[model samples]
Target: MNTRDAKEILLLYRGTTDDSDPQFCAALDYAKSDPELGQWLREQTKCYDTIRTKLRGIEPPLGLSEKIVRSRPIPFPRIWSRVLQLAAAIVISASVTVLLMKWSERRNHSVAGAQEILVTGEVLDMTCYIAYNLSGPDHAECARVCIRNGLPVGIKAQDGKVYLLSGEPGHSVNAELADYAAKTVTIKGRQSVRDGFAQLQVEEIRKL
Candidate 1:
């Protein structure tokens, strides 16, 4: 199987110890032969483990799980596949809901994230922006330095909205930033919250 196909099938592996899954075996063997792919495979496993850990960390509201559990699972070709699909669907749904929630806050109140909206905002270093309200050319150099030093980057919309920027899906934040710091740019993304912080999972960015 090619790398793409192998990656999809391996999603079902779910840390299982069963060696009988031919698809998982094929993906492993392919990854083993390729240095870069092997590294990626390892990294993907680490990311999944981290996500599972965080999910466990969240203290659900009382009886939330019971309510969720009371909902019967629909028959799917595979339970794991259904779980993954449901997770993906939930993310999209949750993102939209969060965006709308933000919109409900105020007229042109941008202190919230937006989903599928084209917004014009000033790029800034997240830490500096929150602590000092710094942005634009005056802070551009400092922002770049801070970002390179591993500080988070974000954008501030005209309506006083702040959004922590992240890459879409599998992209790395650092790699995606690539020096758009402290500039006014337009972005299209899914506006979502992670750990209660606003995030723009950027799909597109255009300098304005």
Candidate 2:
């Protein structure tokens, strides 16, 4: 398979635990021989590791599981019990997949030989914009909340293309641009495109 194909499949990969899945195994093998894809996979794996670490640190409320069990109105038949167990497993899997997609934040890199360019567009809170086509004045407040809470931000150009926004190394542009969500703005930055993903490392931003 090609690098793009491998990347699309690997996005669902849940680290080494998914090693036994044939699709994931094939993607992993392709990634190994491709330097750029390998680097991306490593980054994605690191992001997943960070999420896992944070999840492990969370402590559920005491007696929560017991309370939930007790709150059940009636015990189910064996078949119903099996169905409920299967449902729960499906829910957990779906939740993990959503989390994986939502939190796969890319690190800002200083691209050598990248030239500065100016782009004018409406600021965007990427998650909702990408998932639901949510944008414009009505969605601005929600966009601000999402961006302030660490979701990635972008700018949708007049031609309808979106460029993800970033900041200097070790800094995130989310905080600085949260207030600008859905507003027309102009940004001066260095643009980098890899694997069809475009990111703008903002040097200056001003509302239009």
Candidate 3:
């Protein structure tokens, strides 16, 4: 089987309850008939068995059961009366601060020659591109293209590629994109324009 087909079969084997089904039994029989496929299946089965055995041995900490059963029911007033009031005030103040900061940042970035736009779509796989127009044909124009296509907040262009910056604490795409956009930046490969949108190809997506 091809790599993609193998991957799909492996995924199905991991997720489904059809191991005893006729089709699956036939596939297993076919795999066993081939030396390489037999070895691969054996390895996968060993791994799955090891993981299952390890998981089966796991148990909750000693006293966790007693602690849960003995927990006291807290009175509503004693539980959240003061905490809720304080938390509400804090949330309101924090929300106002965040809104003001966002507004200020938006204005400052706009005046500083950076623009922002939203790119919304369900990313199909971990490898996808943020296509943009480069027909204006200049490096600055490319930068502008990056900015106008969701760059100002944290995305940037480097070596003609658009990079989504890590918001804080590290240099990596946030976890939200970890399962969609493979890398922080995507290199522009082949591009074309159709229906008023520039389509740029992204390459080199593989699990690290």
Question: What are the lDDT figures for the candidates, one per model?
Answer: 0.60, 0.72, 0.35
Model 1 weakest 10-residue run by lDDT: 100-109
Task: Please write out the lDDT profile of model 2 over residues 22-100, one tens digit for every residue.
Answer: 8788889998899978877775665445434544566879987567668974466656865685455435533543553
Model 3 Cα lDDT, one tens digit per residue, 1-208: 5443442244224323557776566566566566665555554444334333443456869987457556954456444754675455435433432443243233311112223333333221111122122122222322332222222222223334333232222222223333333223333223333234233223233232
Say which candidate scores most in TM-score: 2
TM values, all candidates: 0.43, 0.52, 0.28
Candidates in order: C-alpha RMSD to true structure: 13.4, 12.1, 18.9
Q: Which 10 consecutive residues of model 3 have the lowest summed lDDT?
A: 125-134
Model 3 spans > 4 angstroms off? 1-7, 11-18, 63-208
Candidate numbers sorted by lDDT from highest down = 2, 1, 3
Q: Which ten residues in a row have the lowest lDDT in candidate 2?
A: 96-105
In model 1, which runs have C-alpha deviations exceeding 4 angstroms? 1-114
